[model samples]
Target: MTGSRKSADALGEAETIALRVLGFIASTEDLFDVFVNASGVSADHVPTLAEDPEFLAAVLDFLLMDDRWVIDFAKAEGIAPEVVMQARAGLPGGDLPNWT
Candidate 1:
């Protein structure tokens, strides 16, 4: 397949996953809080992620690595792309990595 086609396919999958993650988040406050607190991310991040599927999935992956079920749900569903990019971009400013 062409590069653009491949990119589009990947993005479509990411969007599906991101929507699932958002649905899960709305259902589970525990998971939502876990992601927000553990990620050290703000609610403002949501709108950005909603607009960008790939970034959302990346953010969910980041949150899930903590090994908490609450976070795992987000990873399973996938998050939007921009949120992940923004959150990851901000990590270097933190005293310690979020993974820890």
Candidate 2:
């Protein structure tokens, strides 16, 4: 396979993980409200925002903020916890340096 194909596959996987995270957040009322508030995105706009790589990256970013959240989400999704960070790294703007 070519490099572009690999990149596309990685992006697709990352987007899938992000969508799962969004669903997980939506399933919990408090988390859903918190995500909406923190993202400054309305519930109605989520479907559209879900298509944006940057927005998807933000979803993973939010999920990564808490170790418990990552554990719960990974357990619920049957994915390893580290997969969340890998997915985040695959998304747009994820390659940027984090000076903090």
- How many clashing pairs per prediction, in order? 9, 0
Score each candidate by Cα lDDT: 0.55, 0.93
Candidate 2 is scored at a TM of 0.94
Task: Estimate, for each residue in 2-94, the C-alpha lDDT of model 2 and write its tens digit.
Answer: 999999999999999999999999997699999999989999999999999999999999989899999999999898999999999899988
Runs in model 1 lying further than 4 Å from the true structure: 66-100
What TM-score would candidate 1 get against the native? 0.52
| Pairs of residues at least 3 apart in sequence or in different chains that clash in candidate 1 | 52-81, 53-81, 54-81, 55-80, 55-81, 56-79, 56-80, 56-81, 57-79
RMSD of 1: 7.9
Tens-digit lDDT track of model 1 for 17-98: 5556566765676766766776676878776666664456555464445545434563654643344333433332322445
In angstroms, the error of model 2 at 26 is 0.6
Q: Which stretches of candidate 2 lie over 4 Å from their true place?
A: none
